[model samples]
Each structure stands twice: as structure tokens, then as C-alpha cells.
Target: MFSLLPLGYVGVMTADAGWDTIEKLVFRPRVGELLFNTVALVVVTVPICVVLGIGGAWLVERTRLRAHKVWAVLLAAPLAIPAFVNSYAWVSAIPSLGGLFGGVLISVLSYFPLVYIPVAAVLSRMDPALEQSGSALGLGPWRVFFRVVLPQLRLAAAGGALLVSLHLLAEYGAFAMIAFDTFTTAIYDQFRSTFNGAAANMLASVLVLLCLLLLLGESKARGNARYARVGAGAQANPSRLALGGFQAPAQLGLAALSVLALGVPLFHVGRWLVAGGAEIWTRDALATSLLQTLGYGLAGALVTTILAFPLAFLVIRHPGPVSKLLEGANYISSSMPGIVVALALVTITIHYVPGVYQTAVVLVAAYALLFMPRALVNLRAGLAQAPRELDEAAQALGKPPLVAFFKVTLRLTAPAAAGGAALVFLGIVNELTATLLLAPNGTRTLATEFWTLSSEIDYTGAAPYALLMILLSAPMTYLLFAQSKKVAGQ
Candidate 1:
């Protein structure tokens, strides 16, 4: 059913002006420009994010850096501020920061944490023996990392880079604020200016194609190499590299990153809050938006997580071409921008389920489609850890398949499921584009509310919502850190 949304986009493309329209649009200079902008952002941003993420992770996890725990939390805390908000802070601070450079800067600050967390986790859990062996063989630290440690980080880094690419493709608000024209912003402009979804759908199709390419590349990059050891042994902590003279530089660099990513946004938000006065605190709309945001986030998380379970199970427990194809399809949709998903849903709902068009149900459905991959990734990881032997043992004890799953498999995987749900909830709370389009009449979330006031240049009015958004995301950000640490420790 979720896959049908992208199919609906394809149908819209052909139904109106047939292939000629698509060909003209696809061949247009504007399309080329959009593609370049989109591809350029991904190319530039992903590598920078990778360097920052991996570098930061190495410093925190592998070096004898002081206050490593504090640095880890600080690195991951940027997830509390959405990229769009970060863009607002930077552009507002320096009016000239409104182009590709600024867009790339803000996005890197916002998204490097995505790379940092997973790479850090993998680094922490890595076998000390590998590094020790490399050192014993007379390899230096750099060579050992490049040859041995970096190879093991390939899967995690690739996965994180894939996520960054998908996000750059799907991002609208941040790019829009910085006046960077990606396909996502182009589609949004078409929808808003002329209400011409055919053009938007055409652009969306190209965007989907880009996402498919990314998926394929990441799949090939991940390959089938297993990083886990075959035999069980007492796990030893990896030796920390002596930083010596680099410790100050490393700490200074991390502090600068945290300031850029987290401090600036909070600083700007605080400025607005103070300027906005007590009147900002007394607005009835503030409370309403908070409740609505929480409600939608919870609903979206539950629905997306529930929907992800079966797909994760299918691909993990019954791996094959068919299951892999199904999993890949979900990822393609997950890579789509919220506006694209919302437009596709609008097309389908209006044609076949007009009654639910513009309803909260359809809005939540869009959230589910956009965020299901997060849940699927975590669920699949959890299920992979849970050996089949446990399930079979339960079956041998006379428990039916369903009983065994709930009593054993599900119990074992609950932590992962919960973490995935938390991630989905955080995503839904921060989502802006789809909520703007598909939300029922009079509905508002923190994202939409913040965008509304910010668009109007009413920074004071928007301050409360922005602050609320960061506050709401704080707990989830901490949970994510804890979850990453738990996975690494295991």
C-alpha cells in the first residue's frame, strides 16, 4: 500500500500529457539544474559528514580525550535541532548566508551526527584484537585504522552516508530557507504557485530515481561481508590512543562543532524568546500546537513501528530475492521527500478515498511512509541479534509459532522496537513539509507553527514553538545516545 504512492506519482505523470511531458520536463535545463544542485549537495555534504562523524567518533571513542562521555552527548545532541531551524539560525545571524554554501554548512552541522552515532557505536564494539594484531605487525596507528578499522566501518559509514543522501534529496525547508533549489523545493514551488502537481510529480519521479540509485549504490557498497567474529571469546576493550599534543586540538574542534550545531540554534531561540516577551508565553495557540505535535508524533511512531515489524521480520527471518526486493521497495519510498509523499497521497486519496482526503489519518499515513525505514533498520538489527535457536527452543517446548514470538522473540526484541519507535516519533515531530500539506484544516504541529511564524518574519511568535520543539526532542535525543551506547556495549 505504501509503495502505491510512488506508483500514483508515475500514473499522474503519464495520465496527463503522456511521455512527451515527462521527456520535456526531464530534458529541460531546469531539471538539469535541479539535479545538479541536489547531487552537488549530496556529494559535498555526505563526505564532510563522514569525515566529521568518523573523526569525531575516533576522537571520542579511540583517543584518551578528556570528558569523552560529555563530548559524545554533545555530538549527538544536535539532533534536537532540526536542519531547518539550524538554517534559520545561521541565515538570520548572517543575512548573506543564503545559498549553496550556507545550505551545505547548515546541513553538515545538522546531519553529521547521523554518521557520528553509528560509526561511534561500531568503533566502540570493535574487537581490540584486530587493532592489537595490526600494531603487533609493526603497523602504525594511521595504517592500522586505514587498513583494518576503516574496512570494518564501511557498512556503518555507508549506511550513514545513504541516510544523509536521502535526507538531502528529501529536504525542503532548510534548502528553501537558504534559497537553494533542489528537486524537493522545486516540487514544493510548483505545488504552491500553480497547483500543478503534474510538474511536481515529474520532479518527484526524478527524485525517486535518485533515491533508487542511492539505495542501489549503498547495497553494493555494503556487500555481503560479515564483520562479526565466528567464535565466542571474552571481549576486551580497545586500547585508547594517546592524544598527547592533539588532545587540545581535538577538544577544541569538538567544542566548535557542538557550538555550531547546538549552541547557535539555542542562542538564537533564546534571543527570540526574550524579545517576544510574556505575551509569547500566554498564547493559547502554543499549548494547542504542543498537544497536536505530541499526538501526531505518538500516533505516527506507533503506526510506523507496527508496520515495520512484519517487513523487518520477513527480510531477516526469510532472506531471499523476494524479501530483499520488498525491503528495497520500502527504502525507495522512505527516501522520498515528505512533500512528494504528501502529493502522492493526495493523488491517491482524492481519486480512490476522497472521504479521507485532508484528514489526520492520511497525514499520519504520510508520516508512516516517510519514517518506516528508521523503524525497519533498528528492528532488523534487533532481530538479527536474536538467534533462531531461542524461537525453536520455545517451539520445542510446545509453544505455537505466535506464542513463541510474543513470549520469546518479541520480548527479546522489545528494546530495539522501542528505540525505533522513539526515532520515528522524533522524526514525525520534526517533520514540516507533509504536515503543511496533508494536515486537516486547522491542524498544527510545532514544525508547521514554527515555519508559519518564521515565514512571516514573526520570529518572536515562532520562538515558543521552536523552543518547545527542542525541549520535546531532548528526551529522544538522550534515548538515542543511550540506545547507541547500549548497542555498542552489547
Candidate 2:
């Protein structure tokens, strides 16, 4: 059903008015400009995100920096601030920061943590023996990293880059805030200003193509590389590099990154709060939006988590062509822009279930479809760790298969399941496009509300919602950091 969304998109493309729409939109210089802007942003931002993520991870995990733990948390904390919120902060602080440069800067700052967490986890769990071998062969630290450590980091880094690319492709709010014309923002504009969804759908088709190319590129980059160690001996802590004279510079760099990524948004939010100019912070609006955001977030998280379990179990336990295909389908569907999913649901619901059209049920379903992969990935990781042998062992102890699964596998995977649910919840809270389309009358999420007010140049009115969004996402940010540490055994 989730996969059907893309098929619906195909139907949209081939409908009666489709070819002419595609030809006109495709040949337009505006379409070419949007493509260039989108590709250029990804081309620049992905590399920057990779470097920052890997660099921050290495500094925190492999350096003798003071208060490494604090630094680690600080680096990961930016995940709480949405890219749109970051854009709002920068553009608000400096009104001229409203173009391609600002878009790239805000996106990189907002998303580098996606790279940092996975890379840091891999770094923490890596066998130090490899590094030791490199050192014994007379390789300097830089040479050892380039030859040994970096090869091991290839899979994680590539995976992070793919994620960054998908996000850049689907991102509408941030780029829209900065007046940068990307496919996503253009799609939203096409839908909003002219109600010309055919053109928007064509733009989305281009985005879908970009997403497919990225997935293929990442898979090729990953190749058949195996990162696990061969030795059976217990692993020991890796040695930290002495920063020496570079320590001050490293500290300053980290400080600047944190300020840019995290501090700026918070500072602007605080400023707005103190100025007391927000017209939308009334009791009814605030209470209603908060409840709606929480309600949708919780419902979406729960549904996505439930749906992900069986799929994760199938992929991890029964690794085969079918399982791999199913997993790939999930990835493709999840990578789709929210507008695509929203249009798909809108088409289906309005046609088949007219009573539920534009209802909260449809909106929550969109959230589940868009975010199920977040839950699936974490659940797969947890299931992989919980081994089938544990379930068999429980069965050997006279428990039934179902009972054993619940008693052993589910219990062991609980933390991962919770983490996945938390991630989905945060995603739902921050989701803008789908909510804008599917939310019934009188429903208002913080994301949609913020976008509405900010679009009207009412930054002060948007501040409370933005701050609430950050506060709501903060615990999940901490949860992600703690979970990564647990995975790395740090």
C-alpha cells in the first residue's frame, strides 16, 4: 500500500493532460534552473555534511579534547532544530540571507548530525587493532586514517550522504523560507498559487528520479565491502590522538559549529519570545496546535512502529531476494517527497473513501507511510542484534514460538523499537507538506502553523511554534545520542 503511492504518481504523469504538462514544464528554463539549483545544493551540501559529520565524530570519539562527552552531545543536539527553523533563524537574523548560499548553509548545519551519529557509532565500535597495525607499519596518523580508518567508514559515510541527498531533494520548507527555487519548493508553489498539480506532479517526478539515482549511487559506492573484523579476540579502546597545539583551534571550530547549527536558532527564538510581539500565542491557538501536533505525532509513531516490526523481522531473519526487494521498495517509498505521498492519498481517499477525505485519519496515514522506514531501519538493527538463537533458546525452555518472540525478541528489541518510534514522532511533528494537504479543517500542527505565519512575514508569531518544535524534538535528540552511544558501547 505504501509502495502504491509512487504508482499513483505514475498515473498522475500519464493522465490525459500529463504529456503536454511534462513537455512544457520539462522544456522551460525555470525547470532547468530549479534542477540546477537543486543539484548544486546537494552537490555542495552533501560533501560539507559528510566532512562536518565525520570530522565532528572523529574529534569527539578519537581526540583528547576536554569534555568530550559534552562536545558529543552538543554536536548531536542540532538534530532537534529542523532545517526550516534554522533557515528562519538565519534569515531573521540577517534578512539578506535568502538565497542559494543561505539554503546550503542552513541545510548543512541542520543535517550534518545525520552523518555524525552513524559515523560516530561506527567509530566507537571499530577494532583498534587495525589502527595499531597501521601505526606499526610506520604510517603517520593522517596516512593511517586515509588508508585504514576511512575505508571502514565508507559504508556509514555513503549511507549518510544518501540520506542527506534525499532530504535535500524533499526539503520544501527550508528552501522556500530562503526563497531558493528547488523542485520541492516549486512543486509547492505550483500547487498553492495556481492549483496546477499537473506541473507540480511533473516536478515531483523529477525528484523521484533524483532519489532513484542517489539510491543506486550509494549502493554502488557501498559495493561488497565488509567492515567487520576477522579476529575473535575481545576489542579494546582505541587510542586517542593528542591534539597538542591544535587543541585550541579544534575547540574553537567545534564552538563555531555549535553556535551556527544550534545556538543561532535558539537565540532568535529567545529574542522573539522576549519581544512579546507574537499574535498567535493565544490560549486557543497555542493549546490547539500543541495538542494536535502531539496527537498526530503519537498516532503516527505508533502506527509506523507497529507496521515496521514484521517487515524488519522478515528482512533480518529471512535475507533473500524477496526480502531485499521488499526492503528496497520501502526505501524508495520513504525517499519520496511528502507532496507525492499527500497527492497519492488525496487521490485515493477522495475517490474511494470520500467521507474521510481531508480528515486527520488520512493525514496520519500519510505520516505513517512517509516515516515507516525510520522505524524499519532501527527495528532491523535491533532485530539483528537479538539473534534468532535467543528465540530458539526461549522455545527450548518450553515457550511457544509466538510466546518466545514476545518474551525474548520483542523484549530485547524494545529499546530499538522505542527509538524508532521516537524518531518517527519527531519526523511527524516536523512534517510540513503532507500536513498542509491532508489535515482537516481546524487542525493545526506546529510545523504548518509556523510555515503559515512565517510565510506571511510574521516571524514573531511563528516563534512560539518553532520553539515548541525544538523543545518537543530535544528529548529525541538526546535519545538518538544515547542510543548511538549504546550501539557503540561508549
Candidate 3:
């Protein structure tokens, strides 16, 4: 029920607005323009991200790329810098960077790693037998990769593409900074211009539908395919293909990616920090924002992890229609833009539960809903590691059912739970749209504070917050990459 609040909010808002009002708001030139911008952004960006992700992953994991280990980490390092920070850097460098092209450029640089990390994880664990058989059949390396290898990557690619699409939909700061208008940006504009206005709700309604379509598209793209070996002696390391003449090109591509994605943000942030000098660091608000950001990130992570455990356990321990239904609810809920989730909570609390409106509880709950999937995915994996047989054995050894579950199953999931919590922490710390909408008066997170200063064109003033946010996110980003490798049985 809680998970469905976002859908319900849109439904209720649309109903309240009536068909005429909704039509006026949604079926207009402005809405059409925003839709085109949003769709074009996804269509142009996701494929490039997929290509880059797969190629980069293949090079790092399956080919003789120089400093493969270093490249692996470097490719994923861009994720430590928030998308908006990347936008800030680009806009600072080239103020003319805007519109669809700029949106695509910044988004690809910032988000390709989303695709890379997962596809790389999948590639690292791929069975070389498929490729070997293809080679035996006289297929060249490129042919084997295209025909045999790439098909297997469909699931990962589809998932990564879905993530990229959703990020584009949810993103506001990046596009906003680049002067590109998407559904999220337009929705934010609507809300700011007219708080709880009919048009804003209607725009959110359309955005929600768009999200549902992407979900369905991803479902179709991802088909029901399982890749598990029936019996295995041991997993063998996939043989690395020598790059020969392709070496320099691959290295150059990766180097360029590193420079654009990781380099720009670091350089610009450092420059601003230097310009800001002692004035930025000495600001009391900087320390306050850091502490508040940590406080909120920690709180949100704890809440989300706790909330995710039951759903993950239910799906893992006892898979059934009910569990699947609940799981689907969560995935759909989490896939919605943070703006929609924040709007839903804002509407619900302001109209129904006035006491908690704009409180930390509301903000935390929003974080949990928006990031629960991170926790669920990890907890499900961890739960699978423990197995039902262990719980039965623990109970057989004279322990109560509940005690057995706690001592055995729950204990084993601790590390995964912590990892998921860390991801949730990362998400909340960098989140912008939702924080702007839902945070109470006087609340100041690093993301919110950075946004505040950056909005005023004070990139120098925003420098410390950007630097601190990157610093805070770096470890979590590395953890995310390392965890993916570990999960692939590296």
C-alpha cells in the first residue's frame, strides 16, 4: 500500500483536476515539446551508453587492454561525481552547452558507468565456452562477439538501458543546468511556478505514464531467460583476446572517457575551490550541510534497508504470486522519478497527514521508496546465499523458528544489507529534486546546499559542497564497483 502511493497520488490528482483540466494541461504544445525532448534524450543517450558500456566492459574484462584493472576503476570513477556536478563543470567550461546535444553529452558522460558496471560484472563471469564454440565454427572475434556474446548481454544491456532511461526521466539538475527541458525539469518548473497546481499534477501524471511505458519496454527487452550452468566443476577464467592494432584506439577511447567524465568535474571543482579559497571552507554552513547530509543519508539508508528486508526475504524464501506482486509494486514505485515520489508524499502529507508534512519522517520515507530497490537487490542476493535449508537445520538443532531465522539467515545478510545501505546513502546524499520539494524549512543537505549556490551562478560558492559531495560519494562508488565484481564471482 505504501509502495503504491505515487501511483495513487497521480490518480487522485488527475481525478481531482477533472478530464477537461487534465486535457488542457497534458494535451498541449508545451507537453508535446517536453515529451519530445525527453524521448529524444533517452533514444539518443541510452544506445550510446550501451555501446560504451559493453565495449568498455569487454575491453576491461575480456581483452588485453592496458592497465585493465586501473581502467576498470577509472571508467567507473565518473559515478562518484554527481550528474549535476558534471553539468556544472561543462557549463563552466562552455556556457553555450545546452539543449538536446548538451543534455546527451553530460548524461552519457555521467551515466554510462551505470551501464558499464553491471555489464562488466556480467562480462567478468561469462562462460567462454559459448565464444569458443563460435570460434570453432569459424566465427571471427568480432563475429563471435556480435552473434554469440552480445546476445547473452541483452539482459544486462536491457537492464542498464532501463536504468539510464529512468535516470534521464528522474534527472532535473543536470538537464536544468544545461537549459534542456525534460519531463522532470518541466514538472519542477510547474511546481515552482504554481505550488500544487493542476498543471503540475497533470504533468506528473504524464511522466508517471511515461515511466510505466519504459518499464514495459524493458520487460519486453529483458525476456524470461535464465543463465545458470546445470553442473559445474569450476568456473574458468575467460581467455583475454590480444587487441593488436586495436590497442591504441581502445586505450584512447577509455582515456577520452576518463578525461571527459572524471577529469572535467575534478578540474572544475578544484578550480572553484581554489578561487573560493578560505572563504568557502570557513563558512559555517558548509560544516552544517555536511553534517545534515550525513545525518539524512544515514537515516534514509537505515530506513530503506529495514523496509527492503521483508520484501526481499519474502521473494527469496517463499516465491509466490503475493510476493511477486509486492516485489513488482516496489520496482514500479522505485522506477518513478524522485519528483513524482516527492510530490506524492507532499500531497499526501499536506492534505491528509498535516502533522508530518515537511518533517524529516516524510523526507526519509521518500528516500526509502525511491531507493528501496538498491537494498532489495542486495538483500535478495544475500538471502539466496543463506538458503532455506540452513534455517531448517538451525530449527532442527533445537532453536525456535524465529530464532533460527535471526541467527542464521538474518546474520548472513548483514554485509549485503550494509552494502545496500551504503548505496541508499549515496542516492540520498546526491538526490536533488526530491530534497528541494520535500525538505523542511532550515534543512540543508549537501545536494540542496550545492544546488542553492549553483542556482545563483555562484559556482565558486558551490565548490566546497560539490567537493565534499564528491569526496563523500567516492568510497560508495568504489564499493558499488567492487561489489559488482564480487557478485560476479570475481
Query: What is the number of backbone collisions in each predicted candidate, taken in the order shown?
Result: 0, 0, 0
TM-score, per-candidate, Cα-based: 0.94, 0.94, 0.98
* Candidate 3: residue pairs that collide: none
Q: What residue runs in model 3 are displaced by over 4 Å at the alpha carbon?
A: none
* Ranked candidates (TM-score, high to low): 3, 2, 1
lDDT of each: 0.87, 0.87, 0.92
Evaluate model 1: give its lDDT.
0.87
The candidate with the higher lDDT, 1 or 2, is: 1
Cα error of candidate 3 at position 424, Å:
0.6
Worst 10 residues of 1 by lDDT: 3-12
As for candidate 1, its clashing pairs are none
Displacement of the residue 290 alpha carbon in candidate 2, Å = 0.9
Error of 3 at 85 (Å): 0.6
Off by over 4 Å in 2: 15-20, 231-234, 277-282, 385-401, 488-490
**Candidates arranged by lDDT, highest first:** 3, 1, 2
Q: How well is each residue in 216-245 modelled by candidate 3, as lDDT tens digits?
A: 999988888876545552467888999999
